[model samples]
Target: MHGRQQPAGHRFRRSLTAAAAAGALLLTAAPALAGDGGGRGGGAGGGWVDRQLSRMSLEEKVGQLFVTYAYGETADTTDPDDVARNRQWLGVDNGREAVEEYHLGGVVYFAWSDNLREPRQVAGLSNGLQEAALDGDGARVPLLISTDQEHGVVSRLGPPATQFPGNMALGASGRAADARKAARIAGRELRAVGVNQNYAPVADVNVNPANPVIGVRSFSGDPHLAAELTAAQVEGYQSGRAGVAATAKHFPGHGDTDVDSHTDLPVIHHTLEEWREIDAPPFREAVRADVGAIMTAHIQFPELDPTGAPATLSEPIMTGLLREELGYDGVVVTDSLSMAGVRETYPDAEVPVRALRAGVDLLLMPPDLPTAYDAVLDAVTTGELTEERIDRSVRRVLELKHDQGIVARPFADVDEVAERVGPPRHLTAAQRISDRTTTLVKNDDGLLPLADDGGSVLVTGWGASTTARLAERIDARAGSATAHWAGGDPTPEAVDRAVAAAEGHDAVVVTTSGAATAPGQARLVRALLATGKPVVTVAVGRPYDIAHYPQATTHLATYSYGAVALESATRVLFGEVAPRGTLPVMIPTADDPGEPLYPFGHGLGYRR
Candidate 1:
């Protein structure tokens, strides 16, 4: 309201000489593959977006930049404690309240948003929110409903949603084609549930095994391989039913940093040259592919910008590096502003404004919406932020909506929703993919394909949950597989008892995930191996577990613990499926050659 209305002859502009060149290089390096150009900007609804853009008030333009969380459900919170928690977590009662008050452009649903079990309920919830957005007091453009449907452990959607094998699993398979298929399934299932944007296909080239956050979330440590898979996943995602946008996130890369941006600001000290080699490939490929959106990382790139500001707030990084150097014309969204990485540095009201100044198209989950909205409004009035800048981002957002056809058909089919998820063929395909991705990284003792002549098998691990799951899977495949000492901390007595029990079985299968971070689990594995009972070890999560217990008779890695993955791994051991998975990452060992102990692209198959 404070800025002059309809500021004429204006286009959003910022200096980005380097970003433009790098983006050009990336585009030239690969063909410019992108949005179908089916939507508004260059698509059929171009005039519609322009018409809406022209009539929008300054406040309405700013509202489009904000996307807040749709916390808990609508069951009416009578308890004061429940009310307080809802307010703190979600910022409003439901999507409708946020939409009407802030004229929000979108809402992101988390697991707790609704106890969504049936896909019908999810679609209905999304439809109701869209209807609310349409009738709300704001700009009334259709809301962009989104969720984090990254496959594997990061999958936010619960059962029946076809949790495909994760990135590392795909990487291990060494099949870009399979990655595309996995993405198509993920995107399609998400769209069926009334979700449009998937903030996934993490392009981060995870270079550090100790990187607590991005491990296994990333495709691989090798930049080129990550880029190839990243491009493939993006291409597959946008092709899904109703067309969901795939975002290549944690820009510049969150791979090398050790800190979790969710809790603290992680720093990346790579020189610009090193960055081009280590971090920039995946994002560049994403840009060249014409991905619909690129989410900025919260990590600091002091070399890119000496300001010490996180990429979300650094104009040099967002505008100069990402926008210009990368030539990313698609929407540039900031990672959740609520994360401690930026929030600890910039408090409530100032974060959104700074992000806008830095050239962000979308401000995601600003911890405090009211305060952030008013601050951006105040910045416009004070001329610290210009109306034209707001306008450009709003148009991009609208163009994406126009492109996705959210404006025309925002609601998903409630009855068809659940039916669309996890088709029989998709489950079968998932099993097939999982089966091929089980890598046999080590077999010094060559104890795999444990004797199947009615021999008893004992599955033992530190935790009872996975131990039980593993044992049941093996039993289902082979006749005799039972837990030696299921699910508990690795007490010496417990390890002794499990070791004792392992001797009675024809073979022992030990599962381990926490070796890199937890020493106790490694001790348990070594103790089991020390029993000299032909123990076969499964590195359930990261493949790094084998380094701690390398003397195991046989070692394998599933790259994930998802049900399909675990089942595939057990099947491989029982000789139901031959292990075809390769090592997507190096597992460093003391006797490592020029390459790590088990170099990348190393996997064993059944004896020919």
Candidate 2:
């Protein structure tokens, strides 16, 4: 099942060259299955999967059902933090040892866990982990390495990996093509480092403005728009020869809840009809697009299942609805088993078993891997779960691996990583996509397209980095600028300084993030407005923030604070690109709950 080892540089060059040569052909060609099966029945690489399955022991099959996490960039690391995290989670000192001991079917990387560093280093880490999974004393199958490279705020892979303006920014653009292009670029870049799975294209329709977790991550408030973008991204992320598998997530929708599942379980009161209309469109479209996986949410939908089980543990929701009704044959993965939404209701040992029973093919980030693995093994031993049932999921897992080309081309080219990740072309595409998403919500005073008077400008915002970046961009594009980082909920002193500083500038630019909840941000905006300088408000975080300071005459929304997004906002501010994006979600009036400050689809474009 494993390929012979070669020098890292030599192997990477060969693999990358071959992949590049095949890239164009693979775009139009059907996904290559490992063997003669052609459609999910392939073996390790060239043989039959059934033959491999028949030879597998119960323990091995059990291992294939679990996708675990580990820390450290390499299999062997001396870093104290890496050792501590790996030992704490996997009962091992390094990722390689964990793979060998548990026979892990997959591994998910996270920035905080030190699994992702840079392109070349990440490629090396991926190659090392693959060696352990395929040649070590484990499942002897290629491991499905995954990460939440959702871009925007949820991205794990950073610089040199293209930064997208996130889902809401895509929503504001209202162009499915942009979504597809962004995802394709992200897919190719991720594949360069050998990460084959992307837990992204968040399928939730964020109808609730207060949704703490899914706000900017979601595509839009409208289900139909979300559906279109979801399918487009699925296709885009799985397009090229080096395409990584894309997972559409938070099934049954985590959009309407104000609660974060990591903190507590959120129960959705949507009746079955409401669920179908409001939340199911995106996942339905994802399945139609042949998405590699659909991740179940931890939130509960009582109307869908009266049993009160969260989607992660509910057979009625996962199997009955997602599997039977939706007719999705792809892998069904559970959200992190460690989340309070799933764990609060069940014991640590029972979470994985219940998730599997609920039709989850892969268990992600269980708090304790040893206990979870043992619980699943014990369940099979006690007949609580059948060996055949375990085999079913392993087959699905293996199928995804083969379909994604991981079985044949699991190793990334160390030499090619720098060239392939975040090249100029990808960066241009990212900036273009971000530019299209800048929404000019209001310009009552027509204060934009700052006069080239070489005037000084005041750029103050919540994030220190964001403010500095905006100021620098504006300075280069037009005039002298001073940046002040007004912390979120700015203190009175901070507001006073910004207001006093406004006297030196011809114009004041205020950026807010979640200002609806931060009274101090509103106060700062009002104080700057009272300064009598033309005030231009950029809602760099939430478009909903506009309602918090309704007195402001000019407003724009980038829907993200990503570097490219701020650049896009600056372009729009100076009229480099005409603002074309409209509101994807309504902006309610802060003073009156019933009226909207800005209606959905509302936007103002600069006059020709």
Cα distance off (Å), candidate 1, residue 363: 1.1
Cα lDDT tens digits, model 1, 1-608, are 01112111111122335654454344334322221112224568778888998888887888888887754443332445545665776566555666766778888878765526467767777777788778734567988888788887788887787877799888888689898888888888888888889998899987776788888888887787889999999998888446688899889789888899999999986656567777888999998887878898998877676668888887777776677678777788888988999987777788888888777888998877778889999998998887776777887899888777688778888778756898888888888877878988777666777656777889888556777888888887666888765343476777777877887787788888768666667778888777667778888888778887777768889888789988888888878888888877766673442235666677777684
- Compose the digit string of candidate 2's lDDT tens values, residues 1-608: 11112211111111223333343223223232111112234435435466667778888887877777777877677789889877877888998888888778888998877888898888999999999888944357888899999988898999978899899999888899999999999999999998999998899988777788898898887788889999999999999679999999999899888899999999876656566667888999999999999998999876676667888887767776777668776788888888899988889999999888777788888888899999999999998888777877888888888878888899999999888999999999899989989998878887877776788999996889999999999999766998989888998998998888888888888999999778899999999988888989999886889888889899999999999999999998888898888887767687764365676677888887
Model 2: residues with Cα > 4 Å off, grouped in runs: 1-47, 591-594
- Estimate the lDDT of model 1: 0.77
Top-lDDT structure, candidate number: 2
Candidate 2 lDDT (Cα, whole model)?
Answer: 0.83
Minimal lDDT window, size 10, model 2: 1-10
Q: Estimate each model's TM-score.
A: 0.90, 0.92
- Candidate 1: the clashing residue pairs are 19-324, 19-325, 20-324, 20-325, 23-325, 23-326, 33-289, 39-403, 463-487, 464-487
Candidate with best TM-score: 2
lDDT of 1 at 367: 78
